[model samples]
Target: MNIDISKEDFELAPGESVLIHTNEFIKVPNTLSACIYERYSVKSLGLMISPAHYMNPGYKGNIGLLAVNHSTVPIKLIPGIKICQLALFELTSEPLRPYEKQGGKYMDAKSASISKLHLDAEIQEFLKSKGVQKASDDMAKELGEYLMGHIRASAKRLADILRAEEESQKNG
Candidate 1:
């Protein structure tokens, strides 16, 4: 890990997310993988939501995260919040090639964005095609609530699956 970064350099206001740059952005050597972990210490207990927690090998440039404080209390983000760590490992071969050649969804994410997921027109169209229409002005409020509830349940199911996998990996 021939890289350099510090917390003071990534200073943040009470509610802000800044791109913490690194000294060198290694290319993963085409034969290694990196695992990023968000180093947060709090009693989250499924109540607080952290930022994204994975960065694959072959990713370029300084890694940035779209972190936010989900708790009611204001949390100051010091530059060295230990936001994340990139664990490097030698891979048997290049992992699935570069993102561009793989044509994955995040192939075009040149930088970190704080945008909502599924807010793209392409996704909206897909949802509409699946019969999720915006109700009339009179029904808009109620319809929004209903949709939110459904989405929350779906997200809960996804979280459950992820938790189960993590637990199994720890035990087995």
Candidate 2:
């Protein structure tokens, strides 16, 4: 996934998204992890890197970035430009099992990759146990409604507490 952005800058229209691979390959040791951040200058251009920016220890690959253009106009992604910055941190102790040993879907990926969440063994096991062959739209709708109800209730409770505090202050 070597994107020669230098030869032809990738163009992104407003609200468009693209997955781009880093020009550099990265290797994380068993005792270290990396955090990815959009370069401050790149962010100023109204392009946002995906929020999934944490690289686990023992990851070896070119980092993939899911970028979205939030500006009103189109933006150009120049290849070889430092669009993102990575900060590495050493862990207190080496993990018993590192990313390479975990059988993760994206380990040693060389290019931009779509999510392989559906292929996770744990999730598959859960689904099989529950007799769920696949995800359903109805299930998603029900979950959304359930979460929204809780959010509404929490908001109402906060509003009531704030109103009570305001009244108490006025009386005091």
Task: Report the number of clashing residue pairs per model.
Answer: 2, 1
Instruction: Mark the regions of model 1 whose C-alpha exceeds 4 Å error after superposition.
Output: 1-26, 40-52, 70-72, 104-110, 114-172
Each candidate's TM vs. the true structure?
Answer: 0.42, 0.70
State the number of backbone clashes in model 1.
2
Best by TM-score: 2
Across 1-172, the per-residue lDDT of candidate 1 in tens digits comes to 1113342333233333334333345455456666665555632521122354454565555554545554555554444444455678786777666644544344335444333335456766776899976334345446655886898799889989999999999999
lDDT of 1 at 51: 51
Winning model by lDDT:
2
- Candidate 2 residue lDDT tens string, 20-83: 8887889999999998999889899899998658888999888888999999999988766678
Which runs of model 2 end up more than 4 angstroms from their true locations? 1-7, 126-172
How far does residue 5 in candidate 1 sit from its true spot (Å)? 16
Candidate 2: which pairs clash?
A: 5-79
Cα displacement (Å) at residue 107, model 1: 5.5
